[model samples]
Target: MESAVLTQALMRPAAYPHPVSKVTLIETHISQVFLAGAFAYKVRKPVRLAYVNFASLATRHADCEAELRLNRRMAAALYLEVVPIIAGPGPLDVRIGGNGAALEYAVKMRRFRQRDLFSTMAEADQLTGAQIDTLGRQIAAFHESAPVTGHASGHGTPARIAEVMEAALNGVAELASSTEMTGRVAALLRTRAGSLQPAFHKRLASGHIRECHGDLHLGNVALIGQKPTPFDCLEFDEALRWIDTISDTAFLFMDLLHSGRQELAYGLLNAYLECTGDYAGLVVLPFYTAMRAVVRARVLLERAHQRSAAGAITTAEMATTQMRCNDLLDVACFALTRRPGAITIMHGLSGSGKSTVAQRLALAGAMVCVRSDVERQRPPHGHTAGGGDLYAAAQTARVYRRLRAVCCLGSGAGFPMIADATFLARGHRQQFASLAARRVVSFSIVDCNADLATLRERIAARTGQGRDPSDASLQVLALQQRAQEPLGSDEWRHVVRVGEPAAVE
Candidate 1:
């Protein structure tokens, strides 16, 4: 990686106006970043690529400014301002931030520890389910507020999305030596995505297609203030940033799998779905994840190709990168060739860990979950949040029917589904089993049990929380105890017994 004059000058602490004893320079395929003092300055390299052009100083300056503005959307506290590298008295001498004619520009950002980066933490096996869950909720909140593209903008349409995917496939096909599997799996994804044309349009019309963090992945995120914050978005490409929210989500989902964090991937998916209530996105989620993996493989291979052609990487390094690309393609293959879906329903009292078991099962098997409590609490199509028939018999039956429908939707799309509720009645439990039988997918029930003391304690604590969607009271628990129907022997074969142990002193 040969450095230009400005890059070399910027590698010294003296180049920055801040007082620092040393400097560190990091180089990527498209940019050179100089980390010194309490800030990091990123400068795009003078090179043109298929996806971005920074060959000219003017283009690079514009890109730097755009990077600062776009990244501030998510991490406003971290991104500072775009500053110019002014010419010094000497031809090769340059310094950052001045009033002279600019030689190059850099996006100045408040620097955090490299170890805090999600990619680095993941490498150390330090990423936690809690962090991933928080990150998912964060993304959901951001997407909810992100601006939507105008009707005239062609982004997020089937044609526009296909163009992006087709270009990625072409990149992989052109760069990789063996592209048979790539073409095959991609073809299957294309066909599946094609079948969901109306649904995609519906998603677009429903405001699911909005401006988003285009390059969302573990590498672009870091732990800041004990929270995972994202930076370094796809600033130069508006078409990539303005996309379906699920498509943005697929980037992290694919990244987690590529890193072999399968449980975290599922955790992120479940958290995002639960936060946004965007279960319909599950239909095309696998397709988007597959395409994201393909895009990843192409970018890696392309960057490796560029470096190898420039004599920057050794033959052995190039071989290793090729192997990495192959692994990425393998993730894409898994996304496409996933087996038929399964169904699991939670059978327990209100405080018997039904929700907890559903959450765990979702991570264990990449399942989509629907809870009776949440649906019961969720307002009707244009109604205010609450004040409906809290526990009317008709409302309870409606909630059960909706749960079955969500399971059907997810299972039909080849994903495991979890129905979390106190299925004390045989009829409520039978609805999910019947749907599984009709869909020809596997079905099972998780029967959770806890002592009376634990159930009472949990119910009391949850009631105090005031945030739980369940309206069940202590009196309601007593009623459930009396009215609950025990599972008959006929249902034993499909039951997975899970006991919720009483909490310890």
Candidate 2:
């Protein structure tokens, strides 16, 4: 039950009851995972960190139980059970709930291919926008089902959020490039926190605070048979796990931004709002996102410190750490300082580069783009996929309806929205214009224009690739051209031409 003995036992795969082929040991700051045949055993390290306590065998055992209980909510099949490590004559062995005095406890899990991880998929470009959309809905559903912490629980209140932010910023200030940058972040946090207090209090009153997956990022999710499953939630600290739903999701959004996947992050946010109908939650999202960035900086700083303490730090490595720290600081500051966004609609046929411009706007952090193609392909819950009728009049109407709803939701959340669609119909364009007017937000229509030959060529090329969300082909493009309505005089004033300069307001 000593550290050395535990390490030795984990190193030998034969110690486990399962058939042993090879033993893969993965270590983190607070735990060690031994992946053997058909299973992964996660054993907590005997470290009593500020946020977690796993120092004693009894404590680890209870923690393992908690991990099993909490993670199963989102990933039931993966979290198998908690097993005990029993002492033996020659070596420590996993008892699998047999009768014996246990030395330590490990959370057992069904082993999965590392390649199926969301992070790995992202690196390989195998993660689709539709999958990201599904992930948001799943998270929203999870939050809905999760037990809400009572207001009296003293968790997830505006005061607590401010307290946590101040503590986290103060804790990481020493690692910042200068005290001035730290001071600026603190000031921004104070201002944003004060502004967001009312929204936070409202969320707390409305039961939006619940137990959440505190560490939701690409790494904690995996594609199991094409379903994105999130696991390995923070089980050690209730304070960390119980939070406003948007704040919890901001971690994933901030991670995507950090990794340069801002477009997907924006789509995920839009889809989450569509699922949860919590548009007002946007008021606190910037603050939550900044806090997540600051948390990432704190972690990176801790890593740099550990390397420095060990006398193993290299100049290049130190430089990389410092650069990342500065980058996160900048992101935190940017999120806090972002201007209120306006609604923009991409108005053009598929081959005209409407999606491209929409994505550009989203990456610029101007607004979240909601695409008609992706949403059309996504079937409702318990519904089967329809055929080529996706472009039929009724189906097209449904798509536009959904698009309008999503735009309204985003606008209500105070996020600028971009409707990425052909918008070939004046009625559809007017619907969004009306929504913008009602929402009291500025509106603009981006008309992507190209020659007929160029449009045909682009559509052909896109169809050949077969990876595009759009299914439009030359025939479809022709049909669209014939049916498309030109922008009206009123709509022309709001149109921004993408290709050639046209007379505009």
Report the number of the highest-TM-score candidate: 1
lDDT by residue for model 1 (154-204), tens = 988889888888888888888876668777866887887788789889888
| Candidate 2 residue spans exceeding 4 A from truth | 91-97, 176-178, 303-318, 345-366, 369-414, 419-442, 446-491, 496-505
Ten consecutive residues with minimal summed lDDT in candidate 2?
Answer: 496-505
Q: Can you give the lDDT of residue 121 in candidate 1?
A: 92
TM-score of each: 0.95, 0.75
Model 2, global lDDT: 0.82
Which ten residues in a row are the worst by lDDT in model 1?
496-505
Poorly placed runs, candidate 1 (over 4 Å): 1-3, 503-505
Per-candidate total of colliding backbone pairs? 0, 0
**Candidate 2 on 241-266: residue-level lDDT in tens?**
89889988998888777777777787
Task: Assess candidate 1 and give its lDDT.
Answer: 0.85
TM-score attained by model 1: 0.95
